[model samples]
Target: MSSTKDIDALIEMMAKLPGLGPRSARRAVLHMIKKRALLMIPLSDTLQNVAATARECLNCGNIGTSDVCDICTSHKRANGEICVVEDVADLWAMERSGVFKGRYHVLGGTLSALDAVGPEELRIPKLMTRIADEHITEVILALNATIDGQTTAHYIAGELETRGVAVTSLAQGVPIGGELDYLDDGTISAALKARKAL
Candidate 1:
């Protein structure tokens, strides 16, 4: 067997990770080899543990080591509000924002007619069930600003219309303290369309 075979295999595997290319993976593997005790060993052990235990939350589709995520299991987070997001990353982003106090529903992806993704493919049914089972009073659509995102929001809004749940969208337009000079035309138009009475 070649002495570098296993190391080459490791580099190949690392290259498949989200942000790493072959060149970067080689550098990362070399760095790990240099820091074997501090980073490599611990990282390998953690990766194995997560690979064995990490799972999608059954209730809300969040990624965790348990059937239900910590947010779903926490009594303090049972605030009767559910913020729907397109992906787990979006949910994490909202959490980092620290402005949303309620729980979340991580739809795996947006509804896509081209991809033939329907409500069952996502978590629409589970969301409706959660609304009834958890006594959800409001559903805040936190989808992205893309067409698929808005389409998904409108679909969810229609589903919740007669259920007595208040549906709201994320406010559109420029970001906090964003300069108009740096804004695009579409953003400016949306801001004007969403203008408030104040």
Candidate 2:
């Protein structure tokens, strides 16, 4: 009805993105419009290209522009070790750290009984196949700390145990900059339990 109708729609769509609220979306849209030539056009073209090409990797379920992601295809990644994560974001986070030099398996989500999600719904079967086909000897569970995450980790551990694969979990402890006074009781206990013997 108004001249700003298209701009309003754009703002609404951007607001639906994970971390962007209506106010932030409005600001972002306005900023983009001001830098239309430098930012908006490139962003629009890139979004379209990625939308057309992006797909989940056949091997590890990581989002990529091909059947298998680069990480899965890379010969340098340790073949015997696979990091099992709840989502692609977690995989990316681990990559950012540059610590684990191995392939990753994105489970899509945790096993949720309330939501009726199970191993069949996730990529657990695919993971088992990868382990056997790749001759994997170790699996590092990088799941979150939620109840459902723990349940899924335990279930996967049980499955891998029968296959004679060594299953490990990320050590839960105080963060690099976290203060003990600000941490929750569970974190304190986990950190204490995982303490080194130095």
Candidate 3:
């Protein structure tokens, strides 16, 4: 048997993680092995604990250690607006921005006919329930700028319009310090359409 067989298996599993290729995973595994006493042991323990307790929040679909995530349970986050995102990663990204003070609703994924994803498969029905139960005044669609994302946004907008709630989308524009030459035509057009008075 190969002496490094177990370590190789660990590296292979780590490589399957997003953003970590074989080379990166090999380096990470080697580093963890070298720092076993300091980093590896603690990391292993933490991972085990998280694997045991991590769960999806029943109300909003955010992953947490409990049935309801901290944001969903917080009274301070019960603002009149709910920002809907395509996934938990998007929700985490929005939270990292610290610009939005309201709660979030994760849709799991965009509506993709190819993937057979539909509103029923996502948390759309729950979002409607939240709107009525929470007395939400506005819904901010923060989905990605993909075709499926836009389709999902439009579908949700149409649904909310009939319920008499304001539906808005995140403005598409060139990023701060981004040059016009580097932008796509659709981005340029969207920026132009959403231009504000100076």
Candidate 4:
């Protein structure tokens, strides 16, 4: 039994992390202690470095270790198109797919009436500003297929309707590997409605 108040405090803080509880935090702390040379020291140094340097890009809301993110500053990504996503996770997912070759605008979150989240709360104003500033020609709504997501998309479309920009959305359907038997009624209906010639 170590009398290290600092270690206990660290465990408490780690326990507060998303998806990590007290038990997992304790186990992780113990494992980190055991692998101090291999993991703990490096992790501490990296966390400190990131804490000191991590910042949101001024142009976009993407998190990076600089004033501007790599994507925003890259000339190759200036394709006159902007893909709009709700969160950074969605941006990362689009990046992982390697399908899009344009700039991105993160909305922070969807417009939620229940939660009282509005356009101002997100980066909507910034997005609108970026449209003219970046000389964007098209705005792709890559939001999730939820009710709030569609509402937000429609609101954005309406805003951009007169801005001389083409607005489009991802095709709605069952997922690539989704089984028809396992799909919900809404999924089935959407897939049927969005069906095209194969």
Candidate number achieving the greatest TM-score relative to the actual structure: 2
Reference-based TM-score of each model = 0.93, 0.96, 0.96, 0.93
Total clashing residue pairs per candidate?
Answer: 0, 0, 0, 0
What lDDT does model 4 reach? 0.94
Model 3 earns a TM-score of 0.96
Error of 4 at 191 (Å): 0.8
Model 1: per-residue Cα lDDT over 14-129, one tens digit each: 99999999999999998999999999999999999999999999999999999999999998888999999999999999999999989999999999999999999999999999
* lDDT score of residue 96 within candidate 4: 99
lDDT, candidate 1, equals 0.94
Residues 84-187, candidate 3, lDDT per residue (tens digit)? Answer: 99999999999999999998999999998999999999999999999999889989999999999999999999888889888899989999999999999999
Clashes in model 4: which pairs? none
Give candidate 1 misplaced runs (Cα > 4 Å).
1-3, 196-198
Which residue runs of candidate 3 sit more than 4 Å off their true CA positions? Answer: 1-3
lDDT of 2 at 77: 91
**Predictions in order: lDDT:** 0.94, 0.94, 0.93, 0.94
Candidate 4, 1-198: lDDT as tens digits: 483899889899999999999899999999999999999999999999999999988888888989999999999999999999998889999999999999999899999989999999989999999999999999999999989999999999999989999999998889999899999999899889988998
